[model samples]
Target: MSETGKDEKKTKKKGKGLLVKAIVGLGLVGSGGGAAFGMMQAGIIGGEHEKEDNEPKLVRKGEEDPYAPASKDKETEGLGEVHGEGGSEYRTSYYSFTEDFTSNLAHSDALIQVSLAASTRRDGRVLLWTKKHELAIRSAILGVLADTPEEDVYALAGKERLQKRLTVAINKVLTEREGFGGIDNVYFKSFIIQ
Candidate 1:
């Protein structure tokens, strides 16, 4: 064979070898990816589909709540919370504190007394949690009330703002305790200032 022809043949063989290596490498990678995908789909490996959502779910009006706490009210025993047809898409459950909160207003000596109730659109776990952690939640709410300016308690807008703050405070306590804060609003059952 001529020298140039020999060199050309060697170069061709090397190129073919390189092409084969690249094809095999790609095939291996592709097969690995396919196997991983199959394992995930079969629940043998990754949990992309099996990842359980531990968070509380919203309860639709009139729908059953698997996690709902049993009614403590003797009058409503075995009769679950009733929902009306024509309002919010989700049901609202209220938790009224057994005692009223009394605290001094911020920057003033005036005292404020308020009976509070909290509402949640989530399942009854929230209500159960609130009842379980009432002391912590009550402490948080009292802190919020004590921090509120004296002027805020008198005006409608200020009262609304206070409601929001109280709601956030309650939810914060719940979240810290239960990993989820589900309180949607805080309602004032009674308000008094002295």
Candidate 2:
């Protein structure tokens, strides 16, 4: 073969080899992309399924139905009250307080009433019931009241903050005084700011 013809032949072969390699590389990339897309479509990737068997099962034990309403004999007793034999129940005395405090900023009179229900443990130790915690809760309420403006108390956000503050304060007093007794909650059963 002539030198020029030979050179031309070699160049054509090299071009064909490069084209074949590029086609193979493109095919591999396309296949990988297709597999990833297929996995996503089939929900095998980045998807979650909640199985019915994985859910919590409610089991009925004893004579009580877990799903059914409480029977008359199995009625729940209120806090500080205990059920006795023969279907009788007893409640300990509860402590509570009501006070009127004047706001320094708004110069308004605020009436706050707190109720607590307390109980004694089996060890014969006197425990502050929710009713009794009212006194200690009063101190905490006064603390927050002393800092809150009268207008703010009327606002929705302010009321929420006040409730949270009262909960914290009551819990703090219960922790400090009785060691572990907690106030069920502080409710503004009646609130009036004049």
lDDT of each: 0.86, 0.50
lDDT of 1 by residue, 59-104 (tens): 9987889887655674222223547678899998877788899999
lDDT of 2 by residue, 44-157 (tens): 775553333321122222222222223323122222223234421222222234344334433556544333333322211222233345566566667776777677777998
Error of 1 at 24 (Å): 11
Q: By summed lDDT, which 10 consecutive residues of candidate 2 come out lowest?
A: 119-128
Query: Which ranges in model 1 have alpha carbons more than 4 Å from their true place?
Result: 1-42, 45-50, 73-82
* Candidate 2 accuracy as lDDT: 0.50
